[model samples]
Target: MSQQDRIPCFLLAAGRGERMRPLTDDLPKPLLKIQNKSLLEWHLGALRKAGIQDVVINHAWLGEKIEHALGNGSQFGLHIQYSPEGTALETAGGIAKALPLLKPEDYFMVINGDVFSPNLPINNILAKVAIFRAASNKPLAHLLMVPNPVQHPEGDFFLEDSQISALNLGAGEKLTFSGIGLYHKDLFKDLAIGVPAKLAPLLIAAMEQNKVSGEKYVGPWHDVGTPQRLQELNAAYE
Candidate 1:
């Protein structure tokens, strides 16, 4: 794909994975295996299938191992770049630090490297990029909302006719942020590079202004946060 047509993707893999304990003691969570392939590998394959050639992965804990494992991504038909953080920057901070590599685009796709969503609807999101760009309000982000998993029963935000809002407003059903999204670079303009910040506050701020849009995805999605869940997925995949 041409440069303009190529939507750069940033994979957020820098978390400490404190909950994963000994499994994460030596290996970063993204490198954890599922069905004989690394979790990050699954994302790489999916992105490549969606025609996303340019990818940036941020890593902190056991970051070098990730670099060693993926190399230049040639094997996967992708151009992979690393944004190494001294410490695991929260989601927003990691993306902000990687902005230089992802620049020259009004928006880009970001996915949480730790999660697994085999059918992420990347093509649909790319199709909406043009629509979002031309919108009068110029929304800064478009999120993928999924049915709330048992782990997060309260859910995160409510979606009404594709417009996302922080308040339920007694409207559409509340869903969980799937950690898969299309984000405008302008959303992080105010953040200082290298400093840590969470993405939720930024998303919430935009939601209040009606500057965020989202769609509900009912698909096989898994947040492999704990070793038990990982084992369960491995068994199911087996």
Candidate 2:
């Protein structure tokens, strides 16, 4: 697959940023700057580098700031759309609400807006989607699993042989869900649009059926959850 091949993606931007406090009291967390650049901008820049042409961003808390900051993403060389959840619809609900706008043929990419990963492997992910699409049974989702972060050491799911399971398989590595994944529309099929729903329950259900697959990504990725974490990232950039 080449740059010309267009695959739409949506960034999970709809969140309250409750943890970021006073800084986020005025600005959405994703708008918080790292080296004077908003977190969402990094995702956009990387997506542009990966040749993704279309994008969607969902926002709830102070969402207009997000829109004003990024505009239609023309500056990033990509057409952007927004899914304004009157309130943060958690994850699956936000995706479900945006489903109409996405209408992904098979799978579409989603990345947590809070995570600061300037070098997102979009092409590699698309390649994996190709393989998943060609397999005997298409997985409902493909996740990018990163080593357990200090904030979340227990990890979220188990990865054994490229397959993600909610249950511990005894030998598989239990890693963190990098908040990056390619999901089939069907994964949110039962969810009603506008109703708040979390992605974990849906993913857990899918994992039970062995419908989720993932791969380890030992790269520069960080969950900018706390102000200290953001400060550390900026300090490192300096």
Index of the highest-lDDT prediction? 1
> Best-fitting candidate, measured by TM-score?
1
Backbone N/Cα/C clashes per model: 0, 0
Model 1 weakest lDDT span, ten residues long: 1-10
Candidate 2 per-residue lDDT, tens place, 1-238, comes to: 4433457899998788888998899888899999999999999999889878889999988999999999998899989999998878889999999988876887889999999987778789988767877888889999999999999999988999999998887678999999999998899999888999999989989988889999999989999999999999999987
Residue 136 of model 2: what lDDT?
Answer: 89
lDDT (tens digit, per residue) of candidate 1 on 139-225: 899999999999999999999999899898767789999999999999999999999999999999998888999999998899999
lDDT of 2 at 232: 97
Clashing pairs in 2: none
User: How many backbone clashes are present in model 2?
Assistant: 0
Q: The CA-based lDDT of model 1 is what?
A: 0.92
lDDT of each: 0.92, 0.89
**Model 2, TM vs. native:** 0.96
Q: State how far residue 67 of model 1 sits from its true place (Å).
A: 0.4
